[model samples]
Target: MLIEVRNIFFSYLPRTPFQVRALEGVSLTITQGESIGIVGRTGCGKSTLVQHFNGLLIPEEGQVLVEGVDTRVKGEALKAIRRKVGLVFQYPEDQFFEENVFQEIAFAPKNMGVEGKELEERVRWAMEMVGLDFATLRDKSPFELSGGQMRRVAIASILSMQPEVLVLDEPTAGLDPQGKRLILGKLRKLREEHALTLVIVSHSMEDLAQIVDRIVIMDRGKIAFDGPIRVAFSQGDFVKQFGIFPPVVSQVASLLRSRGFEINPGVLTPAELAEEIRVKILEKKEREHAGSKRGNWSVRPS
Candidate 1:
């Protein structure tokens, strides 16, 4: 396993009157080259859980291991884990502190002792990976860019670290449809070309459906559902209990089934749902044609 969480339990303000439990006996394992989505209602520990993946937060009990090394380790060991797992938080652009785009992306790799031409190349590659034009935007201040551009710059900064696993929280939040599509497209391409394991935390089921092969649904600080994306969304009613609606395609597919249409369950994408509907229509027509032929054969001397 690339990452393993062994029954971790965590809470805020420990031993205090206002303490709030954020995770309870939660265990999960993530493998290399897997794209997983974490979805849940607000305050359900989705963010808190992923924070442990990179050692940002240590559980009060149980263990979180990255490559079999305990996350609680100090110094270089933790830094190595951070480098291997890059996390882009929600509204990550708000954390930008560099004067220019190039500097912003170069910060991580530069801190890792990359310098001169090698650092520049890393920054350029990272920008390219996120669909940013290095030549046009390198010298520009990240704060001066549009919201979508800034988000891309933030992601590129993490990509510059050359992490084997990339974790993002609400990577597509607050963008227009076009911007969302651009970011998601870049992410899909990054997975295919770089083979980076991705763990995305998002409320948008539509976005998750397009990108992740597996879905991990959280509820009240615990994992409520863990399974294939298709299977998770197929249980529309069950998932709804966690305040999550299946993607539009899956909802439509379910509606069709409810109306006695032969649409299949587990339709995650629009294309898949459309294909199912088409097949069902064809089957209906074929059946009708066969019935007509039978009627004609049954007509004896009429």
Candidate 2:
């Protein structure tokens, strides 16, 4: 396992009356090159759980092991562990402080002691990964860029570290459809080309279905379900209880199944649902032809 969360239990504001149990005996594992989605309603501890992957938060009871190194260990061990996991918070663009785009993207790698031509190459590589041209956007002010470009800059800053695992919280939040598609599409290709592990916390079921292979559902400070994307979306009744919507196609399939139509609830994409409908229609037409040929039809009066 690249990372493992072994029966973790965590609470905020410990020992105070305001203490809130954020994680409750939660356990999970992530393999290298895996793309997983962490989803739940608001205040469901999704963000709190992902923070532990990079050693930002340690479990109060159990342990979070990243590449066999416990995040609870401090000093160089912890720093090394964090270097492998890059976290991009929600509204990450808001964290930008550099005056120029190149400086912004190079900030993290610079802090890690990379310098000179090597640092410049890292910045250029990261910008290119996010589809930003180094020459054109390098000297421009990050704050002057469009919202989508600004978000890309923030993401590149993390990528400059060349982390093995990339964790993003609400990555596409508050973006227009075009902006959302741009970021997600770039990330999809980046993960494949770099063989990087990706974990995203998202509220958009449709978006998650397009990019993630596994779905982890959290509820009430605990993991409710962790399975293949289709399996998680297949449980309409269960997910609905937690106010988590499955993919639109899954929802449509379930509605059809409930109406006595022959539909497999495991459908996750529009193409799958469309193919199922086509097959059913063909079967219906064939049955109707056979029935018509059986005997002379008698008209029934209503």
Candidate 3:
């Protein structure tokens, strides 16, 4: 397993009136090279959970293991663990401190002790990976870019560290459709090319449906559902009860079924739903043709 959580429990405060249990005995295992999506309503501890994967938060009552090593074992090892699990927080632009895009992205590798030719190479590669033009944008101030570009620079900063597992918290929270698509496309390519394990904490059902192989729905600091994307979406009642919407395609299919359509329940994408509708129309036409032939035969019968 690339990551493992065993009987984990965490609280904001300990033994106080303000104490709130953020996580209650949540356990999960993520293998290497797998893409997992975490979805939940606001304040459901989704962000709290991914923070533990990189040692940002120590388990108050359980264990968090990365690559079979327990995170609680305090030492110089934690730094290496942090490098292995790169976290891009919500509104990552707010975390940028450098004056120029190049310095902002180079910060991580520099901190990791990469220098000289190695540092320049890592920064250039990271910028290119996130689709930033090195020669044109490197000297420009990070704050001068648009929101989408700033977000990409923030991501590139982490990529400079070259983490094995990339954990993104609401990566597309505030962006135009084109920006969202650009970031998602880059992430998909990175996962395929680098075999990077992606852990996305998002509320966007459409984005999750399109990218994630497995979906884990969290409710009230507990695992509500953990399975393949299709299986998780099939639990409509459970999902509705939690106030989370199924993928748009799933909802469309459900509505069509209610209206007496023979569409399959497994449709989870617009492309799949469109294809299903086309096939159904063809089938209906074929049935009408057969009916017309039968009526003509009856009229000719003596």
Candidate 4:
């Protein structure tokens, strides 16, 4: 397992008047090279849970284990663990102090003792990974770029460190369609090229449906569903009970099925739904043709 979150119970402001339980006995296991999506409503502990994967928030009761080592360790050990798990928050802050893009991207690795050609090479590699040209963007202030570009630079800062597992919280939040695609597309390519394990927390099932293999639905500080995306979306009504709507395609498929069509229940994409609907249409045509032939058999020569 790449990460194991074992029966963790965590709360905010413990022993204080504002105490709130963020996670209660939450447990999840992520294997290497697996793409997983965690979805839930606002304040449902989705972000809190993922923070534990990188030692950002230690569980008050149980523990989080990354690569078989405890995340509760401090100093050099914790830093080493964090290097393996790179986390990008929902809305990454704008880089202000860095003179330019190269410095911003190099900040982390440089602190880790990377310098000169190696540091420059890492910065360039990270920029290219996010589809940014180092030569053009290196000297530009991140604040001067568009919102999407700034977000990409923030992601590049994390990528420059070359973590084994990538954790993103609402990666597509607050973006237009094009911006969301730009980011998600880069992530898809990175997963293919580097075989990086990804743990994505988002409310967009439509987007997650396209890339993630598994879905983990959280509710009220606990996991409500943990299974393959197909299985989880197949039971549309069941998931709906927990306030989760299936992907748009799945909802359409379910409606068609209710109306006597044979659309697959777990259809996750428009293409898949269209293909199944076409098959159903062909079957209907075949049945009508057979009925016509049967009627003619009972009629005269005409």
Candidate 5:
């Protein structure tokens, strides 16, 4: 397993009046090269769980293992776990400190002691991976770019470290439709090309439906569901209670089914729903045509 969380429990401030249990007995296992989506209402411990994966938060009770190594282990081993798991927090731009885009992206590699030719190559490759042209944007200030570009630069910074697992927390929190599409596309490409184990935390079921293979739904600091996206989304009542909206296509398919159509409920993308509707319409039209040709169609005379 790339990540393993067993009966984990964590609190913001233990043994205090303000103490809040952020996670309780949450267990999950993520294999290498798998894409997982974490979905839930606010304050459901999605952020807390991902933090454990990278050693950002140590478990107060239970264990978090990355690549079969316990994160609680001290020194170089813990540091190595951090290097293997690159976390991009919500609004990653807030983490940026470098003046120029090039420096911002290269910060991670530089910190890891990569220098000279190798460091330059990694920076350039990371920038290109995120669709930023080094020649065109490297000299520009990261703060000056649009919100989407800034997010990409932050991701590139993590990529420079070349982590095995990429954990993104609300990666597309604030963006227009086009911006969301572009960022999602870049993530998809990264998963395909690099086979990076990705754990995305988002409230957008529609976005996760389009990209992730598995969905982990968290509610009230506990995992409610962990399964394929289709299965997770099918529990309409459970999903609704968690304040998550099913993907548009799933809702549309449900409505069609209620209207006596045979549309499958597993359709997640607009493209898949469109194709199913088209096929159904075409099949209906073909049946009508056949009946008309056979003189089996009847009409009432006025």
Candidate 6:
């Protein structure tokens, strides 16, 4: 396993009145090259769970291991695990501090002791990974770029480490349709070209549908559903019980099914739903045409 979480439990503000349980008996295994989506309603522990992947949050009870090394390790060992699992927070652009795009992206790798031409190459490659033009944006200040561009820069900063797994929380949040598309498209390409493992935490089922193959639904600080994306969203009622709206496409498919249309509720994408509707309509037309022919009256008596 690339990452293993063995019956972990965690809480905030431990031993205090404000303490709140965030994760409970959470066990999961992530394989290399797997793309998984972690989702739930607010306060369901999605973010808390991923934080353990990179050794950022050591479990209070159980253990979290990345590449078989426990997260409880400190110093160089923990730092190495972090370099292997890069996490991009929601609104990551808000964390930017460097004066220039290149500096912002180079910071992490530089702190790791990379320098000279090697550092430059890592920065350039990371920029290209996120669809940013290194030649044009390298010298520009991150604050001066558009929201989408700044977000890309933030992601590049992590990518510069060349991590094996990229975990993102609400990667497409607060962006227009075009911006969301740009970020998601780049992610899809990154996964394909580099075989990068992606673990995305998002409330947007539609966005998750476009990227992840598997879906893990969290509820009340526990795993509620874990299965293929189509299977997880197949039952609209079941998914809604956990306070998640099925993907818009899945909802539409369910609506059509209720109205006597033979559409699959497991449909995840708009394109898939459209094709299902088209096939159903064509089948209906064929049946009607055949029925009309059978009902025709013969003129042989004349």
Model 4 residue pairs with clashes: none
Tens-digit per-residue lDDT, 1-302, candidate 6: 99999999999999999999999999999999999999999999999999999988989999998999999999999999999999999899999999999999999999999999999999999999899999999999999999889889999999999999999999989888888999999999999989999999998888999999999999989999988999888787888998878777888888888999889877999999989989998998898788678775522343
Model 3, residue 188: distance off in Å is: 2.0
lDDT top scorer: 1
The window of 10 residues in a row where model 5 has the poorest summed lDDT is 293-302
How far in Å is the alpha carbon of 30 misplaced in model 1?
Answer: 0.2
**Candidate 3, RMSD to the unseen true structure:** 2.7
lDDT of each: 0.94, 0.91, 0.90, 0.90, 0.90, 0.93
Q: Specify the highest-TM-score model's number.
A: 1
Residue-pair clash count for candidate 3: 0
Query: Model 6: how large is the Cα RMSD against the reference?
Result: 3.2
> Model 3, 243: alpha-carbon shift in Å?
1.6
Error of 4 at 74 (Å): 1.4
lDDT of 2 at 292: 68
Better of 2 and 5 by TM-score: 5
How well is each residue in 1-302 modelled by candidate 1, as lDDT tens digits?
99999999999999999999999999999999999999999999999999999999999999999999999999999999999999999999999999999999999999999999999999999999999999999999999898899999999999999998999999999999988999999999999988989999999999999999999999999999998999989898899999989888998888888999878898888898889988888997898787788987644463
Query: Lowest-scoring 10 consecutive residues by lDDT in candidate 6?
Result: 293-302
Sequence-dependent TM-score of model 1: 0.96
lDDT digits (tens) for residues 33-134 of candidate 5: 999999888999999999999888999999999999999889889879988999999998987888999888888888789999999899999988888888
Per-residue lDDT for 1-302 in model 3, tens only?
A: 89999989999987999998999999999999999999888899999999999999998999999998888766678988999999999998987889999899889889889999999899999988989889999999999999889999999999999999999999998999999999999999898888989999998988988778898889999988888887777567778876678887898888888899998887888999999999999998898788788887644344
Candidates' TM-scores?
0.96, 0.92, 0.92, 0.93, 0.94, 0.93
